[model samples]
Target: MAQDIITIFHGPQHPGITGNMSVELDLLGETIKRAETHVGYLHRGFEKMIERRTVLQAFTIVCRICVPEPDPNEENFARGVEELMGLEVPEKAKWLRTMVLEMARLQAQMLWFAGQGGSLGHYISPQWAVADRDLILDLFEELTGGRVYHMYITPGGVRRDLPEGFLGRLGHFLDYLESRLPEYDNMLLRNPVFLERARGVGIIDPATAREYGVVGPNLRACGFMNDIRKDEPYEMYGEVDFIVPTETSGDVYGRAMVRRAEIEQSISILRQIIRRMPAEKEIMAVLPKNHRKWEVPKGDTLVKTESARGEYSYYMVGDGTDKLRRVQVKGPSAVHAITLLEEMLVDSQLSDVAMIMNSLGTNPPEIER
Candidate 1:
């Protein structure tokens, strides 16, 4: 006799889910026989909404494309517009943008730590990681006047100059964050529970990763040395020195380790930026005298940025109008959370579904956007 096949939804409301999304699973006992991703539970149609708004108006909302890491979306959108408008950002702005990006990466990784631990039935990691991440958000509030959705990075340049002694405060925060790394390792990375569950689970072959368009830590976890910041340098990335950490295991633990190393790298990059940042007051480029009527030239361009999750790209078009002719975002989660995730979930235990999802850095907003 054949065993009964059970069908169930794993998310869209379950706390273990990464975001507002669900996974449809067909299970034979506790093992998943097949899986399908379900999205659209978010504020959908970001690309369409962007086309209806002016260039400046669109800039404000792009950050919503990925909540955990918004700076990459901002950077991609700003760079795409700048390229089309032939606008040159000030050298100081480039350094500032790079600093913001690294900080964003660090905070997102902290959030990841929390999710990874929480998904595994460990609660202490969330408390520690969220508290530490809030420190970075505090700095962002001081720098950009908003904690979560910072519309600070704009086309041509950043919104404003750094506040007085902001770098000094940032340095102190880095020092504190550095001290906490060992504690994080003890709580999650070195934890025996995390190891048993994460190791050898959700393994993505190196060739499979490339074929599926995987980028960032997930790709690096598969032993690929590919990083957009290194391969395709933009902003102040070309000026910095850092190593792309990789793991040959290609499993959940490997992905976790890559992100952990990157957190240290992010701290190192921020220190370099603070020491080498140029002193210039010119943050914003000269726009048309009338702000609302500003128009970009008739052309199209694609800009890519290495976000905390992976490579994020923006393909933009201008028809010589205040509103963009077209704007489409190609975020890493689009591939990571949908097809790749569905495939990875099959043949895995139902209990590991959320664990695998968090390991992939899946974000529903990015998928829906």
Candidate 2:
């Protein structure tokens, strides 16, 4: 039996790999007997780097913690600092931040469509979904000079007020995205081949989800309807109306369905923001005369937000100095890419490794950081 087992590495470079990470698997023929996650290539010591930087400086780099969905990182870091400093964010700023988060969620979901579909050999999904996701990125570029980093969200509030006519454009885009969801459903969700492949694949036991610290859609797939927006009500989330979708299967199909349903919910949340947000108001809270010289009283706070994948959290500490005493990021992928990935990969066929990883929404950058 020992002779029958063969070990293989499944990439930091392979096309099927989620990111700059690899999975080492021991296989008996095509079935995996053991699996281990490997990560390091993308690490930049972000938490340590933030400790040496001022609050505003740290804001600029938090987005780099998670590439596929960066807004949640910015949100957690900013909110944590705000809590520590006793800074009051403007009401309008809360609405704007909420809008940004929802947009990021929708864009991330679109990117996930590409990854999940590509993993299952559905090329059409990537082609269409990536292109649509670009449309959202275009908006991001307009809002923040940088498309990917988007240091637009700072500790006090947003960097600037909404650009003239930004709301009108966003409304039209939301309408377009709403119309496109049905097409995505027909293309992937309802496809019999995809359905059959995903139905029972990478099944995660409901009992283990919480133990493994699973969050977001993966946890929701287990029929646990926990969402920071609904449960914690940060920013303007409490003011909006949206559903938290859930499924009982706790399998690849269930996770896929949860995300697919969530796209519509994000769209609905964005619509509510557009309708209820104040027409004119301040976007940023008061800042010190010297931004770099700003200091927070000695305190620590943990901020949590629901990212596209799961719960994204940041632990921040200040020592009554301009620089942070410590900053720690607990990305959702930390659990999914390691514990859940390794456990689920065992007994799985080689053909389903990518499928399982995608279903779990493993983003390596977060793990390595």
Candidate 3:
């Protein structure tokens, strides 16, 4: 008698799967034999849509590139435009941008902590992480008037200056987060259940990681030190002092550990920004007489930033028109979700699919885009 092979789709709607993406699996019993990634379940044609819109109009769409970490998208688009226009951001504006980026990292990591717990059938951390994450969202609301999409970081500089006494409130939030770090460790990071499940699952060797274009905490988990902020300093990153955390395991646990350490690094960097921010009245640069009529010079440029998941990059082209000639978004998810995920999923048990995907931080919108 011949053995049976079962075919299944692991979540476009499955809670185990992240976002709105699915994996087609060929399974022998509970073990996945072959896996294929399927995206495009959410928004699509982001690059093509960007090509048709004015520079200002296109700005709104890039934030949707990575729903969990939109500031990196904004930073990349703004910096790419600035490079093409020969624009110089004020020193204070750069610090503000840096602060915004770090906040995004912290919040994204918090959500990941929740997802990691939920993936392993632990409900406690998810609730705690989400509530803590909301505090960060509250700070964002006070700063940008929006909780999810701030649209605060713009081309030449920030959309506006910081509100009165905002830094003090931000400082308080950081202190509270620092105090809660111990709780995170006790509840999740140090939990024996998480350790048993995550320690050896989803191992990606360092060479294969690089070959597949892996970046961010996933790559760092393999014990390779490759951070755009450290290797290629941008904005205020060169000015501030921080460390890139890495792990040797290259498994789910390693990735989790790297992100946890990163949360602390982000907090430290945030404190440095608060201490050394420049005192300047000018935040945003003077736009042209007609903002919509402003055109970028005829040239193309690329910009990259370190987001919580990995490196986020954007390529832009201009034909001396108010509308962009082209805009390309290359987020970490493009590689992690499809190429990396499919490769890692082979021979993996069905139970580990969601845990591994969440560990890799694959966002479906980024894959579809």
Tens-digit lDDT track of model 1 for 1-369 = 889999999878765545699989999999999998888998578878988888888999999989899999999999999999889988999999999999999999999999888888899989999999999999999999999999999987999789999999999999999999998998889989889999999999888899999988999999999999999899999899999999999999999999999999999999999999888788888887665677888999889999888999888899998888888888888999887998888899988988898889988888778
lDDT of 3: 0.90
Consecutive 10-residue window with the lowest summed lDDT within model 2:
11-20
Error of 3 at 29 (Å): 1.1
lDDT of 2 by residue, 1-369 (tens): 355889999887754345788989999999999999889989899888988888887788889888888898888988998999999999888988998999899989888889889988999999999999999988888878777678777899998788888888999998998899889999999999999899898988988998887999999999998988899999998878888999999998999999999998988888888888797778888889786778988988888999999998878889999988998888888998898888888898998998788878889988877
User: What would the per-residue lDDT of candidate 3 be over residues 6-87, giving only the tens digit for each residue?
Assistant: 8999888755444798899999989899999887788689988988888788888889888888899999999999989888
User: Considering only N, C-alpha and C atoms within 3 Å, which residue pairs clash in candidate 3?
Assistant: none
Judge candidate 1 at residue 321 and give its lDDT.
87
Task: List the candidate 2 regions with Cα displacement exceeding 4 Å.
Answer: 1-3, 16-18
Every candidate's lDDT: 0.90, 0.88, 0.90
My TM-score estimates for the predictions, one after another, are 0.98, 0.97, 0.98
